[model samples]
Target: MTLHEDACRVLKEWRAPDGAQARLRDTYLAHLDAYGDGVWRSRREGHITASALVADPARRRVLLTLHPKVGLWLQTGGHCEPGDATLADAALREAVEESGIAGLELLPEPVWLDRHDVRCGGPDAWSVHFDVEYLAVAAPDAAERISAESLDLRWFPYDALPDRTDDAVRALVARAAAALG
Candidate 1:
């Protein structure tokens, strides 16, 4: 099946944690139906992005990247590529690419859905990212390397995430911690 088809199935099967999440799921499904491959990039007015909150095997820490554009300490993720087989694959690939960590395994289900605006350099001054977030467990003793996409990468203890992080990020971490337990 195509990535679009896989995404449709994944969203349909997903059991959202709240009414807000359920609404986001429905919006994502509608976006997929309307945009197809365009939903994967900023080429459209808004697109779907996949991200992951990566935790250590002990679930004590999460890896976050300092996004150059947004200047926020955020989870690893980005636009979906043609090589991606599913949204989960896209999230996992971003985690590995951004964190430079091996043996990261994503939780079978998504942990969060978020929609936010992003500024684009091109004619379109802005775009929206319908972000699907998953929880991934990194290998114990995993080492991290920062890529060009990020100004910095670090592992923060679940209770001590950076102050600059927003409430959504903190909530994701809390949910991930509970899932680990």
Candidate 2:
């Protein structure tokens, strides 16, 4: 089987019976604009995800999402849609919609940048390449609700993330943290 097919099989087998995994499947399919298919290679189509490195200057914490599919801590973001003119605006919209914190201001400049492939979840026909853009600032309020797309949302200290999360996520956090400094 191709790597894409193998990853899909593994995701199917390893997925939990919890209803949340179904949300991942549905969300992936619903957001088809993020992916594309080829004969032998599945590739992540260009997409936008708005990420906020919400740093509480007083508390010195960064907001992060406990993502449902990847099952790892990550910044809040989602696939861009026709409604969004630029990827940065889409990032801000996703962050606010998911976090429910208003009065957020995107940093004048992107703090960090990176890319990753969508390897698993939904159909394993293609990849979604996320051109992740990082924005920084304090959250509007502590009262925030986790969206359906995320299992949980909370803040973490820069030093504590490596021990508390996966390596890939840790790396992204580190990238954002360095830019924050």
Candidate 3:
């Protein structure tokens, strides 16, 4: 099956934790229903993006990258690529590419959904990203290297995320920790 079809099925079956998430889930489903190209970056209204929050198996800490453009300490995630077979695959690919940490295992399901406007790929490139967020567990001895996508990559304690992070990331961390326990 196509990745787009898988995404539609995933969102349709996802159990949103709150009314807010349910609404977003529905919106995502509707977007897909409305545009055959909904999952691609060319979708101006918004495009489906996939991302993952990487944490140690113990869940005590999370790996965050200092985004080159946004300059924010955030999780490893980004736009879906044609090579991706599913949203989860896209997120895993991005996490591995950005963190340089291989063999990371992704949670079977997504943990969060976030929609936000971005000024990525220079000035002319702008759009809202309907992000499907998942949690990935890194082995205890996993070594990380920084890629061109990030200025720095490091792990922060669950309760002590850096001040540069926003609520979306904080909420993802909280959800990821609970999922781990």
Q: Candidate 3: count the clashes.
A: 0
TM-score of 3: 0.96
lDDT ranking from best to worst? 3, 1, 2
TM-scores, each model vs. reference: 0.93, 0.65, 0.96
Over 4 Å off, model 1 = 57-59, 121-124
Q: After superposing candidate 2 on the true structure, give the runs of residues whose Cα lies further than 4 Å from its correct spot.
A: 1-48, 119-121, 139-141, 162-164
lDDT value, residue 66 of candidate 1: 94
Each prediction's RMSD over C-alphas, in Å, is 1.6, 12.8, 1.1
**Winning model by TM-score:** 3
Tell me the tens digit of each residue's lDDT in model 2 across 1-181.
Answer: 4423322343333333346445543443334323432112223343334456555545656778887776777777766554655445666788787776777777654444344566543657446453345565665365667888888888788777634466556655665566567
Instruction: Rate residue 67 of model 2 by lDDT.
Output: 78
Residue 176 of candidate 3: its Cα lDDT?
89
Residues 1-181 of candidate 3: C-alpha lDDT, one tens digit per residue: 8988999999998999999999999989988999888998877768999999999956499999998788789999998999999999999999999999999999889999998889755598778899999998999999999999899999999999999988999999999888887
lDDT scores in order = 0.87, 0.56, 0.92
Q: Which prediction has the highest lDDT against the true structure?
A: 3
Worst 10 residues of 3 by lDDT: 119-128
The alpha-carbon lDDT assigned to residue 157 of candidate 3 equals 91
Tell me how far the alpha carbon of residue 21 in candidate 1 is from the true structure, in angstroms, after superposition.
0.8
Checking candidate 3 for backbone clashes, the offending pairs are none
